[model samples]
Each structure stands twice: as C-alpha cells, then as structure tokens.
Target: MRNYLIAGIAMAATFATTPAFAKDVIVQMKNQGAAGAMVFEPAFIQAMPGDTVKFVPTDKSHSAQTIAAMLPAGVAPVIGKPNQEMSIKVDKPGIYGIECKPHTSMGMVALIQVGKGPSANLGAARTVKLPPLAAKRMTPLLAKAR
Candidate 1:
C-alpha cells in the first residue's frame, strides 16, 4: 500500500510539472470565407505563449507561413507548404504575420497575437510593407492585436 501511494504521488508530481496547459487553436485555410476569397477562416487569432496554432488547409493551393518582416526579434520563421496543414507553437508574445505566398497579392494574410499584453513588435509588424491588397486586409487584423 505504501509503495502504491508513493508511485501515485510521483505520477501526480510529474503531471503537475508537465506542460499540459497548452492548447491548440485551429485556423482553417479557405478559398472563400466571410472575409472574401483566399483567406484564413479566422483572420485574427489571440493565443498564449506555448499554445499551438494549427493551420488546416481546408482549400487547395493555399499555404501558411510567417512574413519575414513581421516576426519578433530572435524568433525563427515558420512556413508551410501549399496545400499542407501546418502548426506553429507560439513561444513568444508578439504579433506574427502569416500569409499565403501565392495569394498574398490578393490579400491572403492573417495575424496571430500570442499574448494579451501589448506586443513590442506590433508597430514594426504593422509597418512592414505588403502588397496593396494584403495591406488593406491586414489593416483591420492588426487593429485587433492587443
């Protein structure tokens, strides 16, 4: 009985120390959504650090990737192949700019905010020049950032 109790306590401790609090937020890539054609179903996402953002390709010929100029300092870029599902684990608190490479000119872009606090890189990300259509689409999404 004592051995069983010790093992149960050990298991509880291990579970408590693990990163089980992280959750996955799914964003679907759609050819046509409420926003229009070639867009992520939810163009704006709010998540916490360590949370995973899963980009599901619900439509063909679409991809999800981070924009170079929109990343937080020291964070590596995350990119997905066209028509493939991709997941990004947001490890930092900031605004991450995502785009469908082929459709960016037509405004296929989205923004993910990792934390609730104001992001230090928000201003810079907003200023990163995008195609005319992407710029117009990003304006409202950026405004949704904390």
Candidate 2:
C-alpha cells in the first residue's frame, strides 16, 4: 500500500512539472506582384492563449506591433523591430491587431484571435482607427471571426 501511494505521488509530480508544448503559428511578411509589400500569409489566425505567433520577415523592412487599443484588457504589449523575426507568446483571450508600422498605410496587417470564440470587444476593435488600407482589409476579416 505504501509503495503504491509513493508511485502515484511520483507520477503526479512528473506530470505537474512537465512543460506544455506551445503551438506556434507563422506569419510571413512579403510582397506580392500587384499587391505590393503589405500582408501576412495566413493573415487570420486562431490561437489559444500561450500559443506563439512568429512573424518572419521574408521581405526587407517590416515590423510587427500589437496595437494597444486593439488587444483585450489584460494582454501584454508586443512590439517587434522592423526587418527582424519576432516571436510573441499570446496569453490573452481576445483579438490582437498587428501591423507593420512602415507599411500600415499600404495595408500590411494581420489579426490573431485567441480563445475559442469572438472576444468581448470585437465591435470596438473593428472600429479602432487604423490606416485606410488596414482598416479596409480588416473589415471583412473581422466578420469571419469565430
């Protein structure tokens, strides 16, 4: 009986200490022939809190910054330098607005929705002041949020 209890305790301890594998989503910044240099492949993503979003620069001079007003109440800020590969760990359940600072007017933007459904402030996020192009692009994407 004592050995069985010890074994059970050890098993529980092992599981508790194991680090959970995080799911990673890749967003590539590049230029299209006519579309110009403004977009994230797989522009719309649904990730769980704790998932990592990797913004890879395939073209030169692109940065990823999360608009503070676009995130949920408790989400930490995410800002990446231009032309660098930035990795963000999302631990908040809401909509995240990402944009390339330099190309925002040209419509380089993407959205990441964390959690299973639409966030509480979805309508407000859709109305945030964004660049003309970015705003236009998000209109349709926001409608498709789960």
Q: What is the per-residue lDDT of model 2 for residues 1-146, given as tens digits with 9 covering 90 to 100?
A: 99999999999998755537558999898875334557888778889877899999988988888878888887787899989998888887789888888888988888889888758868778889987888987777788775
Worst lDDT window (10 residues) for model 2? 30-39
What candidate 2 gets wrong by more than 4 Å, as runs, is: 1-21, 33-36
Clashes of each: 0, 0
Using Cα atoms with residue i matched to residue i, what is each candidate's TM-score against the true structure? Answer: 0.87, 0.82
Clashing pairs in 1: none
Say which candidate scores most in TM-score. 1
Can you give the lDDT of residue 55 in candidate 2? 94
In model 1, the runs with Cα more than 4 Å from the true position are: 1-18
The local distance difference test score of model 2 is 0.83
